[model samples]
Target: MTDDTAVQARRREIASEHLLFKLIEYVEQRHPGLLDFLEGSLDHLGDPAHDETKDDEAVRQIARQMITGARAEIAE
Candidate 1:
């Protein structure tokens, strides 16, 4: 991709991540179901929780999978 496309993509990613964090904060603040939802989804997908890893790799992987699945579903 060109420089412009790369920049735009990065911006999009940043915006998405920001929105996701905000949503998590909102859910956690309001219903406190956010943690349960995340853990449940990850568990259903056969992934481990935060204590399973000291690094963020597992969290990143789960986030990517969730985003990809959501995108595909939205596209349909």
Candidate 2:
């Protein structure tokens, strides 16, 4: 959560511009380092959401990472 209401609203506005940012924010809020998975997946594959040429496996990998991260979070 941002300290200033304006800043937070602005952030939400920016995040709404892309699915990637929205996903990043959602995962970061609950499972910090899991973004490493998204970064790694993107390094290997194109942005499937925006690129019609790419498959959705990268997104699936991120979802898998999220579930794993969520489990780890719950364990802690």
Candidate 3:
């Protein structure tokens, strides 16, 4: 990839990670132990047998819902 493409990819990755972290923090506030559980689950990412595609999509859907709810809360 070209330098510009690589930089763009890295920027997108960072943005997604930041959004994920924010979503985790929001969930953690309401559901105390969930962040710890998610942290523990991250270790499984290195496993060859673990399939993360479905899990990742599920998380994205949930995060979108959380963002929508948070926006509504803020607008109130």
Superposition-based RMSD of candidate 1 using all C-alpha atoms, in angstroms: 11.6
Candidate 2: 10-residue stretch with minimal lDDT: 39-48
Candidates, ranked, TM-score: 3, 1, 2
- TM per candidate comes to 0.51, 0.34, 0.52
- Estimate, for each residue in 1-76, the C-alpha lDDT of model 3 and write its tens digit: 5799889999998898668767866776777776456545553444233655446546655555655555454345
Candidate 3 segments whose C-alpha is farther than 4 A from its true place: 47-76
Q: Tens digit of lDDT per residue, candidate 1, span 3-71?
A: 998899999998997687666666566675555567556534533454645545566576767655444
Question: What's model 2's overall lDDT?
Answer: 0.62
- Deviating ranges (above 4 Å) for candidate 1: 43-76
Candidate 1: worst 10 consecutive residues by lDDT?
43-52
As for model 2, its CA RMSD to the true structure in angstroms is 10.9
Better of 2 and 3 by TM-score: 3
**lDDT score, candidate 3, position 58:** 60
